[model samples]
Target chain A: MTSQDLFAEISIQAEDFSLADEVALLEKDNLTDGAVVTFTGRVRNNNNGNSVTSLTLEHYPGMTEKSLAKIINQAKEQWQIGRVKVIHRIGELHIGEQIVFVGVTSKHRQDAFAANEFIMDYLKVKAPFWKKEQITEAGKTSENWLDAKTGDTDKAELWS
Target chain B: MIKIVFFAALREQLDCAELSLSADDVKTVNEVKQRLSDRNSQWRQTFSNASLLSAVNHDMVAGDHLVKSGDEVAFFPPVTGG
Candidate 1:
């Protein structure tokens, strides 16, 4: 395996992640990187005028990791990147909790920024994780499966 | 037998997690889906959803993809995680 491949990591877990710790680890042993970029997605309290109390994420066990790895590998091929880390939290997550993270390190700001965004966009549309939000409307709480946004699909297709 | 699995909302709607069905006559993913939906009205409703997504052995594919005796097929709604 190439040394660059060793710097990449992907985590799919039920526990929350520390952004600072993740970034530090991504930056570890970096000698040529001049830029690092990271993105985090959080659980919001509301969606489409409903009060979202929490989100429960479910995924196809083996497929989720394979799909995520495919996205990261795509990014690696598209950019001259050094390090990549992707962490996505599953199970129940409350409002204001972090849900996903994508971090990339590269020698140039353009590569780092573009690769990070590229990974996030593709991950949104391609990953096998499904989020079910507990939304309250008129004092009735119901679990609603979020529909894929056309805008998100468009954004991901932009990379193609 | 071919193993079939459901995830997320589709699993809840179908009231099934996983099941094994004889693969004797089913040759494609679409055929398996057609047989599953024939179980009852609830199963029919969920599988007939136009937006349902599916995978064969962890790789996403269309309804016409062929299946084998031991192949695992999964069905679900569109992915929403970022």
Candidate 2:
């Protein structure tokens, strides 16, 4: 196995990210990594039966990056993973636009898959990010902050 | 002084994003909430909500967490990100 340093590859920005470029960066100069798993979350056109016009993500500045680093470190402790990259976009996002991405590389497929899921799950709850949705329907429009669902919390708890 | 911040819905509802309070006046996270709630009816109602969550120095903590000068305390609703 090729020795590697544990690092937190995180980006919190308003700009979009290229998945191909991100994956390539993860795979570049890494001969030990045999499996790479990636997950991308996108804004949907409809949510809870309402037409979602757009989504605005808000996050704590200093804490957001720290939380992501902590999460990546936790994943490293649980699995034999290397080069985990997490990118979450903030500010206004249109329907079908990407919101977040989680990529994990490992020597085996099982470790890669498990670490990818673990990072996403922990990011949902542990990270201090929130989403606000704008809805338009029948010539009327409304905006509200999306509440964190109990199901999401429960899902995160399952990993613990 | 300690910095107190609100995020997301809490920020909108309270019409406040950030504020500073003297550390001598508040010793714990709960004390800060109580002092803020005492400001007005709207503030009282918002802070009184049981679902409100808080963090001190960027890490989630319970109400009894002791705070010090220059520390940042944030309150917000549960996170809704993936």
Candidates' TM-scores?
0.95, 0.97
Per-residue lDDT of candidate 1, residues B31-81 (tens digit): 999999899998888788998888999999999999999999998888899
Q: DockQ (Cα-based) per candidate?
A: 0.85, 0.86
Candidate 2 lands at a TM-score of: 0.97
Best by DockQ: 2
Tell me the tens digit of each residue's lDDT in model 2 across B3-79: 99999999999999999999998899999999999999999999989999999988989999999999999999999
Q: What is the lDDT of candidate 2?
A: 0.92
Q: What is the per-residue lDDT of model 1 for residues A16-125, given as tens digits with 9 covering 90 to 100?
A: 99999998887777867889899999999998888999999988888988998888889988999989899999999999999999999998999999999999999888
RMSD of each: 1.4, 1.4
Q: What tens digits encode model 2's per-residue C-alpha lDDT throughout A120-145?
A: 99899989999999999898989989
Which regions of candidate 2 are displaced past 4 Å? none
Off by over 4 Å in 1: A1-3
